[model samples]
Target chain A: MPQIAQLAATYSSQIFWMLLTFGFVFFVIGLGMVPKVQSTVDARDKKIADDLDAAKASSAAADALEADWRAKENAARSDAQARLAAAKADAAKDREARLAAADAAIGEKLAAAEAQIEAGRGKALGEIEAVAAEAATDIVRRLAGAEVSSDAALQAVKAVI
Target chain B: MHQFTIEPMFGTDHWAIGGYNIAFTNSAMWMVLAAVVIWAFVALGMKRQLVPGRWQMAVETMTGFIDNLLSANVGPEGKKFVPYVFSLFMFILCANLLGLLPLGVIGSHAFTFTSHFTATGVLAILSFSIVLIVGFARHGFHFFSLFVPHGTPGWLLWLIPVIELVSFLVRPFSLGLRLFVAMMAGHILLEVLSSFVINSANAGPGWGLMIGVPSFLLMIGISALELLVAVIQAYVFALLTSLYINDAVNLH
Candidate 1:
């Protein structure tokens, strides 16, 4: 056909150039750019996931530390309460012993005064009764919350000496 | 005066190139003249300036024109083809300008050129062939398939192939026809006009000379117009080829 002949006449050079151009593009894209693009995308996705995982783990650790601090605070509060209770009990026992010792000393002084009054047959017995009575009065005054003390009266006697 | 002659350069006893019934023609001279003009313009533009003269400015137009054209139409990736396009523009431009010269007529021994039908026809084909080859290589056999657009109904599938074949068939025809017609028309016009001018000059006296001057001026004007046409036709031929290739290699 004349058309065929004309086409051939027109396109001979084009046929040659096309074959070379196609081969070059195939070699460049199939072997080079495509594979590189795929691997780079995969690497990027993996990196993102890894960063997210690391972030999650760190946040979890922070939560755990917060929980631990709350638990330790509760333990310290209970321990302080236990120490305070023991101190209050010790103070109460010390106060009761001091009160009992004061009562025993006062009772012993009254009994000694009565024995001196019954056994003596002179003024010494009367003086002993006076001393017992004074000691009982001072003890009653001390028990009733007066500021006067037996040491102040003794200080005056010592000053005369 | 320069010697001009076309003493049968090729043929089987006088036709064709390298071998066949083709004769050497003046078009070849014009082609050379075009080359020199382009070279001289480029040389002129490159010299003397931080600021370019008009000659240099004209030469530099190619660099900017093709650069912008390719980048805008095909994206910056296609800018690589600028040199080929620029050269194509220059060659045709030179050929058209040379067609205007009266150096190669029969009356003038200093310059005369004539082309056999085969020579003129073949030269036009040669330029088209370059475009076709480059495009096909750029896209491959896929280039041939470019005629058929994707997404047609199954019932219409048969028509697609026929349409594609017909479209494929028109490429070489259109490309060759445009250049051949333009060149043929220019030569025929120049030949007919020159004949009239010669005969008219002998027909009268002072009036004959006076009429001849205007006729000569018309020829000169046509010659300049032909120069512009030559470059433009070459560009259209090349650009259409690029568009065809773009269709083949890229869908958009």
Candidate 2:
């Protein structure tokens, strides 16, 4: 084969060029470029991890804030319910007292009215009796030509008439 | 045979060192081309985006492949040898594939430097030298224990160590020869089949239809196989180098 035949003629050049070029590849690409690529990958991995952590922290914080707001809302709702219940009870008590006072005052007024009516009726009856007695004395003196005293007439009216 | 010959690109005696005809040959040109191609592929693809582009991904995939191979074969300590192994793997892989480029249609043939034993031998020796250096540096004289398999019987020690020692010494040659022979044989087979296609077609329509078509189809299949071989050979070289380094480092 020419490969073997040409060995003496070409081996040195092949080796020399191979060494020079291979050395260039080792230094420039292997040594210089590889580390940069690795670092880039490393940096990307770290960034992803960091961003994930930050997202988790933010999500937790949001959940905590929502929980805090929920707690506050529940407390406020309970407080408003308590206040509303207290106001309802106070209004009921005030209404009951006012109704009782009004009822008592009306009863007192009704009683006073009834007493006035009784007094007026008594006076009217007394006046009516007096007037009838005077009328009866007058009738007796006219018909029989006799003097009839007011007391006697009133006694007759009370006894027979 | 002429395809395998390495003639100077410039004048025959233009470039030399120590009077040993180191003229700038086609083999040297291809080697340089492969190296440049590898450098550009890596350097240009390094956009360093957080999300890599296709080109950058390709570059990283290659480096990551070699990295994982080393870590798998040689353990964690193999991390330090990434650059060397990366260079070796890329160089051989690019040289192998570049040789198979269909540039013959353009009347310019690609020279496969890896098909030369001298070139592959140099690569194997380099890998072997690293193993030797690391073995001696780390384990001192105990590095020779690599020749002794763990838990060998006392009676078998005499035979096993010698056999192991011979196998260990043959690694560089075997490594070099494997790649060289694989690459050279694939190319020769393709060339031979292509010659049959040409010669039979030139003979007559009957011969062309009978032998040329089948040979042509076989060449296509073998060419695809050659592409696979190119990748597998590069992988095998790197894998063996790492395994050898593992034995050197761990002495097992």
Candidate 3:
């Protein structure tokens, strides 16, 4: 009861200090301190999000570069195969032309040699006939005292042969 | 007995103005001290770090706690009342802790300003006034309809409203008295137990250990309980304020 009674004498000062102190604290905290702490938290969150975005972008770039390199490599390989095929075709054509020319030159040489040999055999047979005619004429004269013509003797000799 | 007395800090026996006492008393000093301690704590605690230390953690924890309490009781709209509710909680909590210290330089025992009704009554009245003002501002005359239940029978309507009105009116007093009495009683118990130990020790050194040791241990336990009660009482004060504001805003 005495504590209750003391309220009348002490109320004003207590209330005054309470208001002053509480008001000061409210402004300092509600306006100042809380916002600072909140900003830090927000900044930390923003930093993490930015880092993740950067990582995603770099990975995408790497994937694109790898795809481009693989495509170029495939193109180069196909180009080399095409060139090799063209060179092989050209070499085969050149070899076939040379073989055909050699075959034609050998055939011409064989035809010329056969014609010359035929002419020589004709000449040698004619000479042998003349000699046989001469001998036949001499033998007829001595045995029968009658003379025969070269052309006739040759004909007779030929008929007998 | 002497701890409850409110003597002027200065030499004046009588200080008055307009038939009211405006004398600066020990209670006022402790109130100032409570404010200073809180300021120092927050000032030291707020360093704007990505990773908070102990002091910053403490400040942040208290802030988040009050925020949760406000949001839970009054929804998102409760955020506007953070300044007052936060101030009320911190002030009461600091006063209670300050009272527990060996701070009574002029009295026979330690003193706490919150143990007095005059101080706590002012805060309770202030909180109740906010509820009433805000309720009327938001709902106008419909605020009075809070006393009338939705399903009250015609025969019992008169009785229920009367009871409701009485309860509503007594809220400030109840709120004020609850904190004052709780703080006062805990401190008194601590005082009595410690005195018993002192008395036993004065009886004889041998008797001191025999009787005083147990009593001292019990006092230590009570002190821990007092510390718990201090925080709880502060929480209750803020919770009740939020609830009252909720009732005013929603008419529930």
Top-scoring candidate (lDDT):
2
Error of 3 at A107 (Å): 26
Per-residue lDDT of model 2, residues B21-57, tens digit only: 6777888889889988998898877888888899988
The TM-score, computed over Cα atoms with residue i paired to residue i, of candidate 3 is 0.68
TM-score for all models, in order of appearance: 0.47, 0.79, 0.68
* Candidate 2 chain A: 10-residue stretch with minimal lDDT: A33-42
Q: Encode model 1's per-residue lDDT on B8-81: one tens digit a residue.
A: 22332233334322333333434344455655655555543434567645655655665556566666555555
How much of the true contact map at the interface does candidate 2 reproduce, as a fraction?
A: 0.74
Q: Which candidate, 1 or 3, would have the higher lDDT against the true structure?
A: 3
Query: What's the lDDT for residue A127 in model 1?
Result: 61
lDDT for each residue of candidate 2 in A123-158, tens digit (9 for 90 to 100): 876677778888899998999989999999888776
Instruction: Give Cα distance to truth, residue B98, candidate 3, Å.
Output: 1.1
What's model 1's overall lDDT? 0.54
Cα lDDT, model 1, residue B212: 70
Ranking of all candidate structures by their lDDT, best first? 2, 3, 1
Model 2 stretches with alpha carbons more than 4 Å out:
A78-161, B12-14, B148-156, B250-252
User: What lDDT score is found at residue B235 in candidate 3?
Assistant: 94
Better of 1 and 2 by DockQ: 2
Worst 10 residues of 1 chain A by lDDT: A10-19
